[model samples]
Target: MRRTQLRRWIVGAVAIAVSVLVFLVPFAFILITASKTTQGASLLGFSLPDKWVLWDNIVTVLSDRNGLLVRAFVNSIVLTVASVTIMVVLSAMVGYILSRRQSRWNGVITFFVLAGLIVPPAVVPTIWVLQRLGLFKTLPGLVLIEATFGLSFCILLFRAFVATIPRELDEAAVIDGAGPIRLFFRVVLPLLKPVIVTSIVVQSVAVFNDFANPLYFLPGDQNATVQLTLYNYAGGMAANQYNLLFADILLITIPPLIMYIFFNRQIVAGMTSGAVKG
Candidate 1:
């Protein structure tokens, strides 16, 4: 008993140490650097600031270029909300259909869904399509891109979770004179709270932090997402404001961090929900 207890303690201690090193240490470095002067931040070592100027850095970053960061934040929020909403709704419906109906086309549909995850997006072709559709360099177009890229993964998650739901519920709903839409919306959707929350939280972070998609599909200072705001402090004619850059990173990082912290348990539950059953 003593030996087992000691082993458990050692394992726990190691896990804690690893977690601190991997996550907390880096976060601390970012925090410290963001609070430093430009010269101090340029050194980029993990140390406390001689004088905390975090508020000053944040103010400067927010006010830079007539408050580009503020506009970027609005763009990011809109992009994330729109794309994630589309992903959740579309993926949920597709997953439910796939779960309940096993047809000859199911295999083909699943194959394509899986391929979306496996296949690397053809950037030039995608751009050509966007241009042809007159959606090039638009926020709505980027929303579609984000939604499509995330769809496959979200579908898999929802499909697995949907399998855990019994067929009896559907039968009962149908017998109660509920139409297909009514059945799904009224009966099935409510019970999908856990997985829904999971998808929203997961995709929201992905869309909000997405840089490349917005860069390629949605250009212009007016359409800049928060991640693109990092460029305003770095490359091109931008100055060497390392402090403000780190400050921007920290600012943009907070939403996702808070999300993960609060919904940590729900994410675990949603991911593991259908594992045993399906």
Candidate 2:
């Protein structure tokens, strides 16, 4: 018993050490490189700068192209907030109905929702549909696209979480003359706080970091997102300003990273809570 416990403790310690290095090394490189000059950044090795210019790099990135980075930041915020809000509410409602209802159509809807996980989106067709709706090259179009693409996954998450919730509470609410909307908002949603936070954190990160959807559905410099701003700093035919690029990369990465750090516990709990019950 002592030998087995000792071995397990050793393995756990090694695993933790390895995990920290794997995640932090690259981030350390980014932070160090972002503090260097263009010439220094080009080295791209893990070395502290001769002269710390982190603030200068930040200023350059923020002030570049007459504040294009700021605009992209605003666009990303709008897209993330709108898409996440819609995804959470819609997915939760749909998941509740699907979990509670019993019918053949329920299986069909469930299949479609799960299908989103397996099937890759058709970009050209999506663009064509957006154009037909006169929503192409627009922020709202991109928001809808992000929301729709994310809906299935969110629904699946919410469905699993909802299944864990006792039906008795829902019944109790209904018996008290609470309508569906009231039952969900007053009785169900409060219990869903953990999963809701998980969904928001997960979906917000995905939507904010998404590069392809905005590129395909909402094309144009004016509609650029935070991810697109990286292109503004370094791209084909453009002189690669590695320092500025790293600075911008670090700046854009902070929000989602902070979110994950803060909500890490809720995300884990929410994902695991449904497993035992369902």
Worst 10 residues of 1 by lDDT: 232-241
- Scored against the true structure, residue 48 in model 2 reaches a CA lDDT of 91
Query: Best TM-score goes to which candidate?
Result: 1
RMSD of candidates 1 onward, in order: 1.0, 1.3
TM-score of 1: 0.98
| Per-residue C-alpha lDDT of model 2 across residues 1-278, encoded as one tens digit per residue | 99999999999999999988998888888899899988888777788999789999999989988898899999999999999999999999999999888888998998899898889999999989999999999999999999999999889888999998999998899899999889999999999998999999999999999999998887777898999888866787545578888899999999999998999999998888888678
Give candidate 2 misplaced runs (Cα > 4 Å).
none
Off by over 4 Å in 1: 236-239
Candidate lDDT scores, in order, read 0.93, 0.91
